[model samples]
Target: MTRIESKLQRLSQIEATLVDHPEGITRAELARRFNVHRSTILRNLADLTIPVYEEGDRIFIDRESYLINLRLNIHEIIFIHLAGRLMTSNIDRQNPHAASTLRKLSTAIQGLAPQISQFVKGSANTFDNGSKKQDPHYMQVLEVLTSGWARNQKIHLWYHSQETGPIKEYIFSPFFIEVGAFGQTIYVIGRLDPDGTYRTFKIDRVERIELLTEKYAIPEDFNPDDLLNNAWGIWFTNQEPVTIELHFSWRVAQRVKETLWHPTQRLILQEDGSIIWQGEIAEPREMVPWIRGWGADVEVLQPESLREEIKNETIRFMNLYGIFAGSKENEK
Candidate 1:
């Protein structure tokens, strides 16, 4: 099996085993059960890539912590199983492993469906959380970042920024680490420049990484959190901080109050039923496309320069397909 195949299928089997045996299993038995070599089992647990472990000859699974850490519900577990299986079964699929895993996950509810459906009896409970440690390469990256703390020179990474095209390459130094979800978590906060600037890169979204042997000293006063704390998302560039005030109509007043748009956004309700949102941002231009998404539901109140920018954008959008103003055809 390929890496993707092994990753998901192994996790699915591990989950099923954890559900079956609460007390855990012997490393040798686990290897036999999976039909894989003992060395493979040893590598899986020792790798710490997917989250399995062993204590002495006996192995165990940390189910509670695993679920809590990843914030996965029962449905999600089932989904992962079904998906993994499908990927392995369907050779025609592009990412057959991914498809199989998803298929397994989709049918995971059925793993215990018989027990839940026409159950006139119950199975004795022997399931335990401490089974064995899983070794996944993705998890190893976290270990390297948190403890190893090794500055692996400069790395050329392929990253997706605008969310439109392919991941472009950039050379930067990774400094601080943020542990997030189960798989899609773990982001590196570092500076692209040697002068201690700030940048955040998601380890998962990173399509490629090549560490160079050339080492550059990280600035003495570098703080990635301080750099990212001021903005929202990972698009942090050194730009002039500007205040953006927006007026939201009462028609969608509940919308603004319901969701968080940015880290520094503050909402104040006015008597006219409209709400005023105030936020200090370093990149006003980045906010334009998003604010435009709200359309007439929002109106930029201050920073006339931004307003003009939006106006120009509005005109540009209107003319995209030769949209004529005040034309009956445009009314549609």
Candidate 2:
């Protein structure tokens, strides 16, 4: 490895060791463990961002003060492993921070959960291998936005909106960062300057970002969970929540009832062995694609507008597939 790469690796190891051993390890022991000189260990320790203190000949990091020092039980570790696996599988882009997090988690639980640690390590390796290249500006934009959020500072960024078909500039104060449950797309919810109107911006659409000196505070009434309480996904609308009722054919009733699809979901078993599913959400448009995925097995039972929309969409699909409406082929 190059000298810089070696140094960075050593620094990471030193931090991990300190975190793992709250009682601390001697500088001499650290040098021996890594096969480096004592001076090199000291220099590397100084480069660490975590707060570390020397107690006699030993150096220690206070677990309470360390943000990454997690004490998880075996079950919790498994949960984290599964979540990380799902995240890595869904996000097909190179994210150095995510890889680093997986590596650190692997190191933290290697002794207690060796099998899970191996899987986590393998996931990190996949990211490091760069199987897919991310947008060139993604990392930079994410870092700037994260910094701005942490410091309560405003940010100026150039954003490209697919819906509006233009590149617009906004001065924003970030309130929260959220990932869409369905698509795994990361978004920032915040307020725009001057008008102070709340908006959500997708991170990938950010072309450039700059941290501004101006600072702002999140509103007292601004609760992210409350904002998304009735949302189907990341979309929030001022329209009143609507009750959505869907009927599932008996063929898919068992599969439909296997999981809780939403917080407000209620399932009613029918005498015919089919299922009736109902839920309340602010925006019905966000659920259209999921509704379509069920094809003929599911039908929208309420909201005539939404039912008509689905009927129209199905007609379009039929036409696209060279099948005419009211065709005998569909009956067969």
Give each model's clash number. 47, 0
- What overall lDDT, based on C-alpha atoms, would model 1 receive against the true structure? 0.61
Total clashes for model 2: 0
Off by over 4 Å in 1: 1-171, 177-188, 193-208, 212-223, 237-240, 328-332
Summarize candidate 2's per-residue lDDT along 174-219 as a digit string, tens digits.
9999877766568899999999888999898887899998989888
70 in model 1: Cα distance from truth in Å? 12
Error of 2 at 307 (Å): 1.4
Model 1 lDDT, residue 61, Cα: 63
| lDDT on C-alpha atoms for all candidate structures | 0.61, 0.85
lDDT of 1 at 290: 70
The TM-score, computed over Cα atoms with residue i paired to residue i, of candidate 1 is 0.46
